[model samples]
Each structure stands twice: as structure tokens, then as C-alpha cells.
Target chain A: EAGVTQSPTHLIKTRGQQVTLRCSPISGHTSVYWYQQALGLGLQFLLWYDEGEERNRGNFPPRFSGRQFPNYSSELNVNALELEDSALYLCASSIRDRGPEQYFGPGTRLTVT
Target chain B: AQSVTQLDSHVSVSEGTPVLLRCNYSSSYSPSLFWYVQHPNKGLQLLLKYTSAATLVKGINGFEAEFKKSETSFHLTKPSAHMSDAAEYFCVVTGERTGRRALTFGSGTRLQVQP
Candidate 1:
């Protein structure tokens, strides 16, 4: 089976612009999660969606939001982006009923100037 | 609340030598631990996971991790290092206390294998 897949491997945007990253979960997976891997900041959780509902989110600002579709694919949106927002955004998916094990995607690298 | 700490920021080892990556975790309840490896410009790959079933969990690519509940540690190890094993490894933790299974990842340890 195919693992999680992400779109737009690399993106370049300027400050104050908006960006959206996409992810498609593996078949039979019901939970989608978003994470930001920034330089010096390491990896931090951004959002979690399951069964088309916003289950939980991290300490990130409201500017960082996302949603999961009925097919279990997800899209992360960043509004009024800042230089610090530039980082690798990764998406992971897992079977909600199963344990917490997750499979990851290649991630989209967003560069904000 | 849940968190993970990778003891080493970087480790260098020679080919055919043993490999050890240390990880410590904190959680309010029983935790699910995982080891993920990422190659340069590549996605993270699952190396192993401990989900309360087995204390000694073996994963893909000859990698394994032992979970020590008393020590709150889940360390990854490999009997023999290969050149392809050079990558960044992350230790992750999640628990029921962390609602919705939000994962807490470590700072990551970069492994370098010398020929």
C-alpha cells in the first residue's frame, strides 16, 4: 500500500502571503496530523484531524489551521505568513482505532522571504 | 503532557560496528514510543514502535528498540551499522493523556557512518 503523500515539494512565498499545503493519507487511515519542522525549532505538532473533525491542535497561532476531507486527505493553511513560518511541513496519518503509530510524507518545504 | 529527548545530537560510527541512539520520554500515562529515520531530502520512515505489547520491538532494516518503563527510556539499536544507515533519527511519544494522540518529537539525532 502507498504511504502518505504530499504535494508541492517546495514553495516560496513572501511575508504576509498565504500558503496551503496538501496531504493524502494512506488507504484505510482515518487520522491526519500536521507538523512543522523549522530550523532551530525542531519538530512541533500543528494540528490533528480525525473523521473530518478537528480533534486537537498544538500551541501554534490561529493562523495555522487545517482540515481533513472525507477521503482522509488534509490541507494546512497559513495566513499572514511570517519569516518564522518558513519550514518543512510534514503530514502523517494513522488508523485511529489502532495505536498511535503514524506514517509520514515527504513534506513540503515552504520558504518565506 | 508528553515530551521526548534525544540524548545525542550527532553520533559517528564505523561500518560493521554497533549503533546506539538514546531517547528518553516523559508522559503522564503509559506512552506509545516510536523511532523514525529520515534520509537527506526524504520523508520520515518508521524504524520501530513500542505500543505496550512487547518491551523489545524489532522494526524494519535490522533496527530494534527496547522499552524500559522504569527508566522511561526507549533506545534504538542496530547490531551492525551500514553506510545506508546514515540519517537523522527522531524519537516520538504519545499517550492517552495527550488528547487526540498528538505526537511529541525529539530534537533528533543525526547518524554518520564511516567506511
Candidate 2:
């Protein structure tokens, strides 16, 4: 089976611009999660969507939001982006009922100037 | 709350040598632990996971992790290192106690294998 897949492997945007990153979960997976891997910041959870509902989110600001579609694919949106928002955004998927183990995508690298 | 700490920021080993990546986790309740490896410009790959079923969990690519509940540790190990094993490894943790599915990841440890 195919693992999680992400789109727009690399993106370049300017400050104050909005960006959207996409992810498609593996077949039969119901949970989609978003994470930001920024330089010096390490990896931090951004959002979690399960069964098309927003289940949880991390310490990130409201500017970082996302949603999961009926097919379990997800899209992360960043509004009024700042230079600090430039980082590799990763999406992961897992079977909600199974456990917490997640499979990650190649990630979308966003560079904000 | 849940968190993970990777003891080493970087580790260098010679080919055919044993590999050890230390990880410590904190959770209010029983936790699900995982080891993920990422190659340069590649996605993260699951190395192993511990879910209270087995203390010793074996994963893909000859990697394994032993969960020590008393120590709150889940350390990944490989008997023999290969050049392909050079990558950044992350330790992750999540628990039902948090009532959230978001995972806490470590700072990550970069492994370097020398020929």
C-alpha cells in the first residue's frame, strides 16, 4: 500500500502571504496529523484531524489550521505567514483505532522571505 | 502531557558496529513509543514501536527497541550498522491520558556511519 503523500515538495512565499499544504493518507487510515519541523525548533505538532473532525492541536497559533476531507486527505493552511513559518511541514496518518504509530510523508518545505 | 528526549544530538559509528540511540519519554499514563528514521531529503520511516504488548519490539531494517517502563526509556538499537543507516532518528510519544492524538517528538539524533 502507498504511504502518506504530500504535494508541492517545495514552496517559496513572502511575508504576509498565505500558504496551503496538502497531504493524502494511506488507504484505510482515518487519522491525519500535521507537524512543523523548523530549523532550531525541531519537530512540533500542528494539528490532528480524525474522521473529519478537528481532534487536537498544539501550541501553534490560530494562523496554523487544517482540515481533513472525507477521503482522509488533509490540507494545512497558514495565514499571514512570517519568516519563522518557513519550515518543513510534514503530514502523518494512522488507523485511529489501532494505536498511535504514524506513517509520515516526504513533507512540504515552505520558505518564507 | 507527553514529551520525548533524544539523549544524543549526533552519534558516529563505524560500519559493522553496533548502533544505539537513546530516548527517554515522559507521560502521565502508559505511552505508545516509536522510532522514526529520516534520510536526507526523504520522509520519516517507522523503525519500531512499543505499545505495552511486547517489551522488546523489532521493526524493519534490523532495528529494535526495548521498552523499560521503570526507566521510562525506549532505546533503539541495531546489531550491525550499515552505510544506509546514516540518517536522523526521532523518538516520539503519545498517551491516551492526554485525551489527544497529537504526538510529541524528540529533538532527533543524527546518525553517521563511517566506512
Candidate 3:
């Protein structure tokens, strides 16, 4: 089976711009998670979506928001991006109610100038 | 709040040598622990996980981790190192008391294998 897939492997934007990153979970997976892997810092959870509902979120601000679709795909939107927002945004998916093992995607490298 | 700490930022070993990557986690309650490997420009892959079941968990690529509640650690180990094992390893903790399943990853330990 194909693993989780992400679109626009790399994204470039300037400060104050908005960016949207997309992720398609593996087949039969119902939970989608978003994480930001910045330089030096480790992977930080951003959002969690299941069954088209926002389940949980991290310590990030309101600017970091995301939504899941009926197909279990997800979209992470960043409003008024800052240079610090630049990082590798990863998307992971797992089978709901199964376990905590999540498969990840290649991730989108967002570069904000 | 819960957190994960990787004791070593980097570790170097010769091929066929044993490997050990230390990880310690802090949580008020029982937390689910996991080990993931990431290669350059690649996504994270699950090496193994412990969810209050067995103390020892085996995963892909000859990798395994032991969950020691007394030590509050879940350290990854391998009998023999391979060149392909050279990647960033992350120790993650989740399922905290708040019922949050989103993982809190460690700073990561980069493994270097010498051929």
C-alpha cells in the first residue's frame, strides 16, 4: 500500500503571506497529524484531526490551523507567516482506535523569507 | 506537561558493532513511547512502540527498545550497526494524562556508522 503523501514538497513565501500544505493519509487510516520540525528543535505537534473534526492541537498560536476532509486527507494553513515559520512540515496518519504508530510523509519544506 | 529527552545528540560506531541510543521521558502517568527513524529528505518510520504491554519491543531493521519504568527511559538498541542505520532517531512520548495522542518528540540522536 502507498504511504502518506504530501504535496508541493517545497514551499517558498515571504513574511505576512499565507500558506497551505496538504497531506493524504494512507488508505484505511482515519487519523491525521501535523508536525513542524524546525532547525535544532525537534518535531513539534501542530494539529490532530480525526473524522473531519479537530481533536487536539499543540502550543502553537492561532496562526497554525488545519482541517481534515471526509477522505481523511488534511490541510494545514498558516496565516501571516513569519520567517520563523520556515521549517519541515510533516504529516502522519494512523488507524483510529488501533494504536499510536503513525506513518509519516516526506514533508513540505516551508521557507519564509 | 510531558517531555522526551535523547541523551546523546550524536553517536558514532563502526559497522557490526552494537548500538545504543538513550531516551528518557517524563510523564505523570503511563505514556506511550515510540522510536522513529528518519533518513535525509525522508519521512519518519516507526521502529517500535511500547504501550503498557511488553517491556521489550522489537521493530524493523533489527532495532529494539526496552521500556524501563524505573529509569523512566525507553532506550533503542541494536546488536549490529549497519551503514543504513545512519540516520536521525527520535524518541517520542504520547497518550499523556490529558488523553492527547499527539507525540512529543525528543531532540533526536543522529547516528553515524563507519564502514
Docking class of 3: medium
Q: List the residue pairs that clash in candidate 1.
A: none
- Single out the weakest 10-residue window by summed lDDT for candidate 1 chain B: B94-103
True contacts kept of each: 0.85, 0.85, 0.85
Could you report the Cα RMSD, in angstroms, for every candidate shown?
1.0, 1.0, 1.1
TM-score of each: 0.98, 0.97, 0.97
Provide the lDDT at A1 for model 3. Answer: 97
Which ten contiguous residues of candidate 3 chain A have the minimum total lDDT? Answer: A94-103
Provide the lDDT at B101 for model 2. 77
CAPRI-style docking class of model 2 based on DockQ: high
Q: What is the lDDT of residue A87 in candidate 1?
A: 93
**Higher-TM-score candidate of 2 and 3:** 2
For model 1, state the Cα shift of residue B54 in Å: 1.5
DockQ of each: 0.84, 0.85, 0.79
